[model samples]
Target chain A: AQSVTQPDIHITVSEGASLELRCNYSYGATPYLFWYVQSPGQGLQLLLKYFSGDTLVQGIKGFEAEFKRSQSSFNLRKPSVHWSDAAEYFCAVGGAYGNKLVFGAGTILRVKS
Target chain B: EAGVAQSPRYKIIEKRQSVAFWCNPISGHATLYWYQQILGQGPKLLIQFQNNGVVDDSQLPKDRFSAERLKGVDSTLKIQPAKLEDSAVYLCASSLDGGQGQETQYFGPGTRLLVL
Candidate 1:
């Protein structure tokens, strides 16, 4: 079964600090990876996606993710965290040409000033 | 250009009551999906439709839960005698063509359901 795992349930970081959210996936074959962010009382928005080619993919809102095939991970990173960055982040995986996506539990990011 | 649309931003009903939610996918999108997202958890796919036809509904609870996309554009999901566990945010998403590789799905604002 294909699945996504977000190890951290909640994380707090100081504003202007670097941030990294860990994600791991289990799939039988090459997986389509994605990172989505949701703000309070808002629908989820796509941050970035990794299908093939370059390991690093840039997304909206100044977010980026690196897909590590060997580790089966697609981790999201940000160089400078802002107060607006406090939100829930989810990692999702899908099979080739598969419309259905498997999302992780999600990580709640808290930014402290 | 508009994203997916859902109706009734919030609904509160007593347990054992019936409730229904509606969704309008993006214009020209051929694939529609309904998902259930419990608090503190990820969204779980309940049903999928491919242009008025059912594609994947294995995860949908047919006993008390039902959904349809008759015109292949707008869809509806209903729960009869709703249970407390059924309280969650119902999300609607759409893609141009699910058959294509790496199809990006755009989501709606979601309906928050509360079963008292």
Candidate 2:
């Protein structure tokens, strides 16, 4: 079965520091990848997605993810972290035309002053 | 465009009780999905609908859970005799269509459920 894994359970960074969240997937075929963020006591919001074409996909809120097929990874990165960026991040894997998405356990980010 | 809408921001019910949640997808969206999100886990797809038709329900626990999307717009998910393990947030998401490459799912605020 297709699955997504986020190795980092928790990450803390000082405000204005760079941030990177790792995501890996296991699937028989190339999968559509997505990154989503969730605030405390709230639903998830899509950050970015990679379907085809470019290996690097840009998303909202100055976030981006690079789809590395060789590594089976689609890690999300931001140049700087803000206090407002403290939230849980999830990575999802889906098929090219399927609506069913398999999401990772999620990584909780903490931005300190 | 208006995002998906869900009712009952929070619900608390004892085990063996019945509960139902409602969701209205974004106008014109052809696909709707219902998910279960545990406290420390990512959302899990429980059921999916494609314009009033059942698209997927493989992951749903049919013995206790049932969902329907009638009129192809609004949906409802019900659990009979809810169990303590059913405590979680229920999320509703909608997209234009699964076949379209531009389809991006929009989620609702979700309804938090606590089963005692």
User: lDDT of all the models against the reference?
Assistant: 0.94, 0.92
Candidate 2 segments whose C-alpha is farther than 4 A from its true place? B100-102
TM-scores vs. true structure, each candidate: 0.98, 0.98
Q: What is model 2's DockQ versus the real complex?
A: 0.65
Q: Judge the docking of candidate 2 as incorrect, acceptable, medium or high.
A: medium
Candidate 1 lDDT by residue in tens digits, B1-116: 89999998999999999999999999999999999999999999999899999989999999999999987899999999899999999999999989865888899999999999
The 10 consecutive residues of candidate 2 chain B with the worst lDDT sum are B96-105
Top candidate on TM-score is 1
Worst-scoring 10-residue span by lDDT in model 1 chain A: A93-102
TM-score of chain B of 2: 0.97
Residues A20-80, candidate 2: write the lDDT tens digits.
Answer: 9999999887688889999987778999999889899999999999999999999999999
The residue-by-residue lDDT of candidate 1 on A22-76, one tens digit each, is 9999999889998999998888899999989999999988899999999999999
- Which one is best on lDDT? 1
The candidate that wins on DockQ is: 1
